[model samples]
Target: MKIWNEPYLETCCRAALHRLVLVGGGGRPDGLKDGPCLERLQGMGLARLRADGRYELTEAGRERHAGEILKLRKAG
Candidate 1:
């Protein structure tokens, strides 16, 4: 089995992930300023683009958010 090492994310990308979570994880773009951040997140397997063309957090992204952004500990 492969171990999961958390990828390093920039401040902007973290903010973008938080925003994605706040917005219910899909639908509607609040402008296009986050393209680069989204791309980075997508490349890291943290976020994914939906069929409707909106970006949302994957399971890893949500876990990252809970740990990094929200400062919550993950339960084993």
Candidate 2:
């Protein structure tokens, strides 16, 4: 049996994820120069391309941002 593991993002990729979240409402933000990092995030399903030719965070990405980036956790 194989166990699925969470993808590990490097510092650059994590920074890219943060940038996407900061953009919020969506529509490419200025100064987003991390193409490779964004591509890596896309491959991991953490971010996606918008119809307007911009990249945004997916639901999974938001959750990850909340948990990993913002360090927010659900109350147990």
Candidate 3:
């Protein structure tokens, strides 16, 4: 697993937030499916690339997503 740092956490957290918003709106954009952004999350084991080229949240990702939401709620 990749080391968790402030920058990486921020990136992943923001990505998680974006994913949440997109999921709520409908779905992810095509560009994000196989993009480097998702790839980074994939490498971190927070996301999985499906055979259809879509990203699905791993269990870790679900936790991260919930954690990110908590952080944001606290920040606000």
Best by lDDT: 1
lDDT of 3 by residue, 1-76 (tens): 8666633555644665457445742434446533666667677887776766566667777777777666777899
Residues 16-40 of candidate 1: C-alpha lDDT, one tens digit per residue: 9888888874542634798899888
Backbone clashes, each candidate: 0, 0, 0
What TM-score quantifies how close candidate 3 is to the native fold? 0.61
RMSD to truth, every model: 4.7, 4.4, 5.1
Clashing pairs in 1: none
Compare the candidates by TM-score and give the number of the best one: 1
Q: Write the per-residue lDDT of candidate 2 for residues 1-76, one digit (tens) a residue.
A: 9665778778888889988888887645433579888878888898887767788898899988887778623443
Model 1: CA > 4 A from native = 1-4, 28-31, 72-76
Q: Name the runs in model 3 displaced over 4 angstroms.
A: 1-7, 20-30
Please list the residue runs of candidate 2 whose C-alpha ends up more than 4 Å from where it truly belongs after superposition. Answer: 1-4, 29-32, 72-76
